[model samples]
Target: MSVFMISQLLIVIAICFDLMSFQFKQKRMIVTCLSVSVLLTSIHFALLAQWTAAALMLLAAVRYIVTIFSYSKRLMFLFLAANLVLTVVTFGGLTSLFSFAGGSLQTIASFSKSDQRLRQIMMVGISFWLVNHVLAGSPMAVMMESLFIGSNLVGYYRFYGMKLSS
Candidate 1:
C-alpha cells in the first residue's frame, strides 16, 4: 500500500484510541488513551507531509503523557508556549491555525481537574481539529475527529447525566 493509505490506516487505529478515551471516567486513563492516539496521529500527519499538524500532535502526545503523571498550570503554560513556537516554525498557513487552536484547547483540557470539563474542552478542540483535518486532506482524521466529538458527548452524558457543571 501507498504511504497515504498507510497513514489512513494509522488514523483509523488512532481513532479507536481517541474514541475509547472518552468512555473512561478517570482523567489519567483518558489522557493515556489520548496519548497513544496523538502519537499515532503525529505519524499519520508526518506521512501526509503536514509538518504543522505532525509537530502539534507530537507536542500533544508529550503533553498528554506528562499530564497523565503530573500536571500543573506551569506545565500547561510551557506546553502552550511550545505549541505556539511549533506552529510558528511550521507555519503551513491558515490551516495551521486550526491545529494550533485545537491543540491549545486540548492542552488546557489536559490540565483540567474535572473529567466533564476535560471532555467539554476536548469537544471544542476536536471541532477545530475537524477543520484542520479537512484542510490537511486527511479524510480519516476528519472522520476520527467527528467520531471523537460524538464519543465525548456520549461519554459526558453517560458520566454526568443532564447537568453540565464544571
Candidate 2:
C-alpha cells in the first residue's frame, strides 16, 4: 500500500473510537472518546494534505473537549460562530459548500441536550461531510463517514427502538 493509504488508516482507528464513544452512558466519557477520535482524525487530514479538513477536525476536537467540561448554549453558539468564520476563511468555491453545511449542522447539534437529537444532527453532518470527502478525493474520509452513518443507525435503533423520536 502507498504511504498515503497507510496514513488513511488512522481514520479507521478514529472511526472505531467514534463508535465506541456512543457505547458510554456518561456524557463526559462519550465526549472524551470523541475528542480523542477527532484528534486522530485531525492528524489523518493533515497527513492527507487537506488543510481545511485538518482545521475542522482540530476545531471539532476542541468542541468535544469543551463538551466534556460543559454543555452550555453559549459554547454551542461559539462553535457556530467559529464554524462560520472557518468556513468562510477556508472557502474553495462550490466544492467546499458541503464542508460548510456539515460544520453548520454540527454546531447546531451541539446545542441539543438529547443524545438522540445529537446523533440525528451529527448523522446529517456526516452525510454532508461524506459528499465533501468524495469530492475532495479523500477516500479514507468517505469510507469513515459511511461507516459512521451505519454505526449511528445501529446505535439509534438499539437505543431508541423503532421510533426515531428524540
Candidate 3:
C-alpha cells in the first residue's frame, strides 16, 4: 500500500472511467477533466521519484492527444487500436513499463529488521497513497444518474460508498 502503488491502482480505475466516458460519449468535458487530473498526478509523482506512476500519466497524455486529434474514421480507429494495444502492454506490465512494485507485501516483509520509525513511515506512506487514490480516482467509475444504477444516484457513493473524505 505504498503511495506509489496506490496511485498506480487509482490510475487503472481512472482509466476505466476514461474508457467508459468514451464509450458513452461523455464529450470532451470528461476527457478534459481526466486529462487534467492525470497531469496533476504526473506532476505530483514526478516530484516524489515515483517514476513508474508518472510515466503512466505521461502515457495518458499521449492517449489524450490522440483522442483529440484531427483524423478520419480510419485513422481514429487506428489511433484507438494502437492506444489500446499500448495501454494493455503498459498497464499489464508486459515489459516492466511503469510497474508498481512498491507495495507487494513482499516489499513490506523485506523490512522486518528496519528501524521502527522507518516502518511507521512506510505505513503512513501506504495509507496516504491509498487515500489519494480513492479521492482522485473514484470519480471516473460513475455516470452520475444512469438508470441502471438508479435515476437519482450519485455514482461512486451509490456504487462503493466512496466519498473523498477530504
Of the candidates shown, which would achieve the greatest lDDT relative to the real structure?
1
Question: Which one wins by lDDT: 2 or 3?
Answer: 2
How does residue 81 of candidate 2 score in lDDT?
A: 84
Query: What RMSD does model 1 have?
Result: 0.8
Instruction: Assess candidate 1 and give its TM-score to the true structure.
Output: 0.98
What is the number of backbone collisions in each predicted candidate, taken in the order shown?
Answer: 0, 0, 0
Instruction: List residue ranges in candidate 2 displaced over 4 A.
Output: 1-3
Tens-place lDDT per residue, model 3, 1-166, is 6655654555454444433432222334334544654565565455445454456555555544444443244543454354345445545332222123222221231222322322233333334334433333433222221221231123334433453322
Instruction: Compare the candidates by TM-score and give the number of the best one.
Output: 1
Question: What is the C-alpha local distance difference test score of candidate 3?
Answer: 0.39
Which portions of model 3 show Cα errors greater than 4 Å? 1-25, 70-166
lDDT of each: 0.92, 0.77, 0.39
Q: After TM-score superposition, what is the CA distance of residue 6 in candidate 3 from its true location, in Å?
A: 18
lDDT of 2 by residue, 9-84 (tens): 8888888887887676566766777788878887876776666666777898899777767779888888878877
Which stretch of 10 consecutive residues in model 2 shows the poorest summed lDDT?
22-31
Q: What is the TM-score of each predicted model, taking all chains together?
A: 0.98, 0.89, 0.34
lDDT of 1 by residue, 33-149 (tens): 999999999999999999999999999998998997776999999999999999999998988999999999999999998888888888889889999999988899999998999
Q: After superposition, how far is residue 134 of candidate 2 from its true place, in Å?
A: 0.7
